[model samples]
Target: MPTSASQEALTPLRPYCGRFAPSPTGRLHRGSLAAALASRLDAHAAGGRWLIRIEDIDPPRDIPGAGEDILRTLERLGMPSDGPVLWQHDRLDAYAAVFEDLKAKGAVYGCACSRKEIRAAAQALGLPEGVYPGTCRGGTGGREARAWRFRVPDRDVTFVDRLAGPYTQNVEKAVGDFVLKRADGLWAYQLAVVVDDIFEGITDIVRGADLIDNTPRQCLLYEALGAPVPRYMHIPLVLNDRGEKLSKQQGATPLADDDLLGELERAFVHLGFERIGADSIEAFHREALRCWADRFAEEPA
Candidate 1:
């Protein structure tokens, strides 16, 4: 079971291990850079290990050489991973093992319903739209299984975010029985991410607020697997002109190669830090680390 807030306050802090996982859909944009920088600063402030992971599981959307490009960009911008990069595509065996384990525990089941069918079932049953109605929970009715879904419990999951404070979500109502593996036979993000975080011993996850909704589902997975849930800090996203979160789909442009220090400074300010006024990259990082520790230090136990 997860430690309660009261219990957590009494325990010593764990060895800090953090990661910045980015999909290889395109080059790193300003928004992604801000996320990477914030994660790096947070880890450095805590005197922890900060690593990188290439979330390249979905081949259909992945660009050729994009993973390598992202790693190269980080290195050029003076924010390289402290450890070896974990490529999700190379960890298929690990995901498969976790899937098998969930199956053995009866925490996941075959789901044959298509999107259209699920919507129809939800309408017929008067349930909220887009939330799965557990159509195949009892059985697939002899229909060929098109996907595998995790059986979310009907209860509230609450967790504390370093920046966003305490939050709760009832996973079963918000997302219902979410897919563990898609109809196309690929591992789902929730399963892959939780398994990888466990394998890597990630103690903290600091990323963009765009992923905040994914936390509750992941927390449930951690409980089902009997693994400890990590601390999270969901920083504000760098939005586009339309106020939409900047993303590849939103036509966000890649980070420019010229003036790396200037670009880093912009990202630093976007993270709510005052201008460090450092002439060199090394000096800038040094000052940024000090400033980050001052502002976002962990509360006293």
Candidate 2:
């Protein structure tokens, strides 16, 4: 059993908390806006705190000022964070602490294999591609530790998404021992995200559908650390002319500020809300909160 101090470190500050965490790679486009609006509305419906977190852990991919710009756009849309925004870059120590806990518990190991080595090994052994073959799980064998990986249980991990419904994945078979920290000396998204959500007491997670596959990995992390798993709802993605998910890498345009009402309307419609004749942000949110609650407020059966 953990001592009181260690237990306190893992406890959430609120009973219900939801967050919209956006990476600083680009400005908030329509796809991201819809997700942000949904998360805020869900929090409002649940009478919970909705926080905004800047996922700026990947400095190389982050635009220097994109994070601040995203927050400004959110404020313009009348969906500012409920509390001071948490930036992942500012919480390295916290991530390290959690990693140490996992390491001490024997739930993680050092991985010395490079991506090339893993791919080659998988091809050679006829293992499914992209699944680590446990090359370094035993020990580095005189090689340097390039990254830290979480050991996954062999059984299936199942969870019901509020919007997507029942979902399951065998993390060990599908993703193998996934990374907690990278060889580049930066924390992995899987580790940072789970740790942040746990520390913040996030009871619900609302994001894009593209991230559905990442849930099982995070679930494993939460279980390993004995933290409560948050409920998940992954909203649909906004597609572009090419029928591709609108993303920064896909050259998605930054949200135009001139027609905030029109933008919000489109986002609401994308989330399956009927168009409303709202003239202001306040009116839109008022109706949105009602619509969202009517649809998703009850716990999924």
Candidate 3:
């Protein structure tokens, strides 16, 4: 069993070990830059390690040079990681090991339900308000291989976010039985991320608010795998004119190489970092680090 002391040690304000896990579906945009800078600063300010991980498990959606491009962009913006980058594609065996453990613990099962089938089942049950109903919990059949889903408990999984404050989600309702491995033979984000974060010994997770809901599911995975859950900080997302989050699927423009400094400044400001003079990228990083250290110096015990 884990102790409160161990949990307290994982706090974001403590010796920071943060990471920016970006998918390789497209080039780095303003949203990605903000997350990268925030995680880097948070780690560096606490004199901890800042690492980068490429979430390229979904090969179908990955671009050929997108990961390399993202690394180059981060370097140009003066946010180089402390160690070698972690490529999720190269860590399939690790994910599989955890998946097998979960299966042995009776915490995961397969579901043959298609997207259309799920939608129709949701409507038929008249409980389409929100959340998955876990129609195929027991088993659909052994005839065809389908997606694997983790079994959610009835109680709530709660966590405190540094920025968003307290958040609670009843895993059984909020996000029903979530996928571990997809029908396309790709390991789901929930499983891969949980395993990777544990493997990398990440202590703080700073990412877009869109992933805020994902924390609970990940927490449950951490518990099931007997791994420590990291502290989370979800920064506000960069939205478009229509109030939609900026994303590659929405055709968000990539950050231009020439405007690296300007873009980094914009990302810093967007992340609630107060700008304090200095023009160059190195100066920006130095000031940002100082600001963060001073800001967290008064954190309550």
Candidate 4:
């Protein structure tokens, strides 16, 4: 079980750990920078560890040098990870362990359904589009499995976000058996994330609200693995004029300069952080850490 993000004193944890994980599809946009700043602030405030992970699991979509470019941008922004950074590419073996564990528990099954077939099935079944309809709970013999999916129950997975408040998702109905490994043979985010969080002892996850829907599914994986779930806080997203979440796919522009402190200050203010007129970058960080610490600090038991 995980401690609630309810501001109560979290059970004595392994100190505290947080992370900034970006897919490296493009440079860091304002929205990405805000998430980075929020993660850094929460870690510093809690006197915890902050780390980085490059989520480059999909090789075909990866721009060869985009990962290094993201690292350079973060370095210029003055937010550095506490320990050596982790790369998803190098962690396949680790993920495989979790995959096998789920297989042993019969928590995952093979699926050979194509996107087209799934969509057709959704229409015929009258389920919402995009939610897979569990078309292949049994093995699709002869044809190799296109993907591996976790079998979700109809029961609800509930968790409170420190910032977003209560949220729930009944994975079975909302998103039927979701993929653990993609048809492209790449690892799925759901499986990799739960394994990594457990590996790193991550205590809290603070990210953009766009990922709020992903929390419940991840929680289900946590339960399947019998691991502790982390507290979550999904912050408001920085959207483009089109009302879409700012993302590389939306052609969102990346940080174009090396003005680390200036960009950091702007991102800090963008997250509704207040600053004293005379505070230097260092001063703002100091005070901001104190403020976040108080806001997230565990209530005295």
Give me the candidate number with maximum TM-score: 1
| Per-residue accuracy of model 1 over 1-301 as CA lDDT, tens digit each | 4323323222324788889999999999999999999989988888888999999999999999999999999998888899999999999999999899999999999998999999999999888888999999999999999999999888888788877877788878887999999999999999999999999888888899989899888888888898888888899999999899999878899987887788888899999988878898888899989999998766553
Candidate models: Cα lDDT each: 0.88, 0.87, 0.83, 0.81
Q: Best lDDT goes to which candidate?
A: 1
Model 4, 210-249: lDDT tens digits are 8999988888888788877787778888889989988898
Clashes of each: 0, 0, 0, 0
Q: What is the Cα-based lDDT of residue 145 in candidate 2?
A: 96
In the range 1-301, model 2's lDDT, one tens digit per residue, is: 2111212222323466999999999988998999999999988887889999999999999999999999999999999999989999899999999899889999989999999999999889888989998999899999999999998878887767777776778887888999998999999999999999988888888899999999888887877888767778889999999899999989998888899988999999999989977989999899989998898645532
Instruction: Give me candidate 4's TM-score against the actual structure.
Output: 0.92
lDDT of 3 by residue, 82-172 (tens): 9889999899998888899899989998888888877777778775554667877877766464788999888877777877777778877
Count backbone overlaps in model 4: 0
Superposed Cα deviation of residue 280, candidate 2 (Å) = 0.9
Q: Give Cα distance to truth, residue 251, candidate 3, Å.
A: 1.1
Between which residue pairs do clashes occur in model 2? none
Q: Which whole-number lDDT from 0 to 100 does residue 49 have in model 2?
A: 90
Candidate 1's TM-score = 0.95
